[model samples]
Target: MSIPVITLGAVASAFVPGLEQLRGPVTVVRRCEELAELVAACQTGLARAAIIAPGAADLTASLVDRLRFTGVVIIALRDHPPGAADPVVDGIDYVEASVEPAVLAAAVSRAVGRFEAESARPRDSHAYADPLGLPDVMVPQPPDATEEPGTGRIVAVWGPSGAPGRTTVALNMAAELAAAGSSVLLVDADTYGASVGASLGLLDESAGLAQACRIADQGRFDGAALGRIAVSVAVKGGRLRVLTGITRPDGWPELRPAALGKVLEAGRSLAEVTVIDRGFCLEADEELSFDTLAPRRNGAALRCLEAADTVLAIGAADTIGVPRLVKALAELDDAVPTATPRVVFNKVRAAAVGRAPETQLREAWERFGPSVRISAFLPMDHAAADRALLAGTALLETAPASPLRLAIAALADVPAAGDTRRRRPGQRPRNVKFPGIPARLPR
Candidate 1:
């Protein structure tokens, strides 16, 4: 039987003669000039298998998602071999770009058989969102009482581009959750500015996140492996396991697609609460025709939100920050509707929004997002925050009874339905190094 195919590359037209040599009626009938045209062909069900080159237009996760929805298998032609060191993302199969015509045909034939088998079976719930079926990092609360216990909670602490104390909240949240006798893993996932280590006084320059991502890229990231990368920090009642972000600014590419999620999945087995301090950018810039699995700084943050059981969408109290937060809320809803966010206002003061700041901020946010109520407003605590940062420790340790610590502790008290007793602080499951790092935080 014949198979339908679409070709997209600079020398795409030259491949027609080669495709015609297939023993079966293999048709390279459609040649897409632009990404839009290729997408259109896939939408109309004209393209079955796309033979795409390394740099064929802007191939984004969103586009790959679209193709997967319409039952299109992506056959990527790269200069490298398919193995542990390959730079390919999920949702696409890779073959050597310089392969002979006959070898290419074999790949296409396999793609057809794989597609037919997959299409015939019941559709996967995550087929369109994450077609590659990379490990489902999400540990959703068990629907019934019979569901698994001790599944950790993922709380993504995110906010707008302008500084709104996301790291502070994340650290405080981890501390509070730890104080409640839950093991915590605080991850610095803010690709734009990774300050969790510095805030906690850790100066080891280990680039823990980059190393974990490297291991994941090699497809050897499991729970045992995850334990090796984490640095232990004693909080209060329980310990805080930290996964430091990239060592440098341009190191975002180190965190490839599905890598961070694999780390999160691994962390769940060790911790009771996972606090991911995410970057400000939630935008999915999949419009670039690069590889569908291209390295994106914001992609890590997006995945954190996707896998989170609770999303703390925070923002600054005043003028510019409030407006950005409002716009961000709408974008968040459009992007990850599965994540039900709890809105928070950081650095709230009467001077920022005048008397009755909460009421005014609520009134302003109600226009754009009527259903999203301002759940909590963190008060301005300069002295306590400064002391914690300068001391290279958590606010709870510096000022245990401070208002800031109390506020975060209140948030930690939010009921978790399917939780079991967790380990205490300073309990090292994997003993690699000593406890704690001397942090340097930015004001």
Candidate 2:
């Protein structure tokens, strides 16, 4: 039986006549006029492979991944020599447009053969499974012997709405971690409002997180690739690597949950600790209303929370903020049952809760909030915050002596297991305990 193949793009169509001449190895089933038609043809199971031009309309890494998920072997026909300027599309084989018809056929056969061989292999029962239930995606490799255990801990900074300082906490925490001599990768995973690049005084034009997700979706993510995409920011004591988030909200479809998971997996090999600044919403209503395969706007945040080793749930210190945080905590618990977020109240001040705000807030929390203990109370330091924002630098650099900076620095002292770095002499440790926070709230 001849292998059935579909062709798209003008460059690909030019080979149809030649391909049809050599009928034994492969057959041209349909010449699609557009990407949608090609996708539809592949979905109908009429084509085992698709040969598309690199310039096809709306061609993206996400589309390539979707086609591959349907078991369609993709071959890109390039009319020019490969160069640094050429866009790298992962998860697809490339063939020169000038290649002979026989050679093209051979390339398609080889790709299909490899795909079949991989599909037939015995599955590993203990391997990391895709929580999204995606098929044929690459399984992340296990840590090598040289890597220290528990080194690459993912700490996601999440908070309820009303500007509870999620980015502020995430950025400073990452800087503090780096200052302590640990390699850090600070990722802006907030699709709705990504400002890590802007916050650190770096160019926000390139969407580093989205680009990383594209590479990860193709199963090509590695330490070197991560290093290339991440911008290095020099902190006071050490340098921190950062992956900026999407430039626009419409780019959310690029940050699929499955790909984000892979990106986090690869991050373990790149940095000792990965701090993700997450968005506010955790609702999955899109999944309920649309097709199972439709993109969910809040999926990225939920995925990060689920994969985080530690979750820093921040909330503003006020009447409205406290109630919102309480409700959000319940929503988070329902969304990710395994997550135990360290509750943090930002902008804690006398104006918000009246005299001795910490005392009153703690008392009220004990009575009304979830059973989880409050981890940290960041004082309202509008001047320091404004200074840092104006300078486009972390508090560690802009206002090192600010009370807010001191609080974040203290939080970083509670290191991962096996981390024995001692605090500077005379630096007092904050009275915060991590053991009491229950994984699930009481019924």
Best by lDDT: 2
> For model 2, how does the per-residue alpha-carbon lDDT over 1-443 read when each residue is reduced to its tens digit?
78899999888988888888997778999998888788777755677789887587555687776676555788888878778897777767888888999999999998877775553332232122222233422223232312332347788999898999999989988988888788888999997899888787664466778877765664555666676667677666677878889968678777878888888876777888899999999997365332334666689999999989889899999999998999999999999999988898889899889998889899999999999889878888999898887777788777876767777766666332222336687545342222322322111
Output the worst ten-in-a-row residue range by lDDT, candidate 2: 434-443
Candidate 2 lDDT (Cα, 0 to 1):
0.76
Q: How many steric clashes does model 1 contain?
A: 13
lDDT by residue (164-251, candidate 1, tens digit) is: 9999999888876766677777888888899988887665466677666655643455555555566666654556777877758767
Candidate 2 backbone overlaps, count: 0
Q: Which stretches of candidate 1 lie over 4 Å from their true place?
A: 1-150, 287-293, 367-369, 414-443
395: Cα error in model 2, Å: 0.6
